[model samples]
Target: MSETTMNTATGATAARGRGAVALTVARVVLALFFAFSAFAKLIAHESAIESFDRMGWSHGAMYLIGALEMAGAVALLVPLLSGVAAMAFVGLLAGASVVQLTLLDPVNAIMPTLLIVLVVLIARDRQDSTAQLIALVRRRA
Candidate 1:
């Protein structure tokens, strides 16, 4: 191969490596945020129940939501599952945002909205990574 072609290939590989690292970092940060929230809800049942009551939801619903959050958070740590987890959180966050806007202050809705954006970004990044992996596998085959 020509020298310029080799350099181009090397640069492309380095860029892909950097992209993977950034995606991994984002996944970990998001996973930690969701996990902490879930832990709080699970450990402080009274607080969670009160929060749910304010939202016109039952205490049982609070527990169920917390469990779902915990499951999604755990899935986020797995590379293959992070995309699905992010997609799930996008839906969950959307519901939370709507509830916050309707029942609480507009300011309260901002966090869930922001989280939805982050999860969407993670989902897109994961999709790109998956596509690249599939392309590589096809090339090998």
Candidate 2:
């Protein structure tokens, strides 16, 4: 191959590699954030219970939600795990936001909306990471 052609190919390859790295880093950061939140809820058992009670859910349901959140947080760290956990949290937050609005309370909805947006950003980053992984695999094989 000509020298100029080789340099162009090299630059393209480097660019792709950099993009993939950036995406992976973003995913890792997002996964860490979700995991940390879940861990906090689990660790502060009493606080979670209190939160559930305040929300008007039965104590049993509160425990269940805490467990679910922990599970979802762990799932976010695993690649190719169907992303169900992340999706579940996203839905939960979105629903909470709507309920907050229905109750004619603004504060109840704002935080949930923020949380939902964070989840969506994580999901988008994850999707980009997955696409890059697939492309790399295809390039190799």
Alpha-carbon TM-score of each model against the true structure: 0.77, 0.56
- For model 1, what is the error of residue 20's alpha carbon versus the real structure, in angstroms, after optimal superposition? 2.3
The list of candidate 2 runs beyond 4 A from truth reads 1-33, 36-44, 99-105, 128-141
Pairing residues by index, what is the TM-score of model 1? 0.77
Q: Residue by residue across 1-141, what tens digits does model 2's lDDT show?
A: 999999999999999788657645655665576566566565666766666556676766655655776677666667653244455778877877876776446676898887776666556646755566568779999
lDDT of model 2 at residue 106? Answer: 64
The Cα RMSD in angstroms, rounded to one decimal, for candidate 2 relative to the true structure is 6.6
- Clash pairs, candidate 1, are none
What is the alpha-carbon lDDT of model 1 when measured against the actual structure?
Answer: 0.84
**Alpha-carbon runs more than 4 Å astray in model 1:** 1-13, 128-141
Poorest stretch of ten by lDDT in candidate 1: 128-137
Error of 1 at 18 (Å): 2.6
The number of the candidate with the highest lDDT is 1
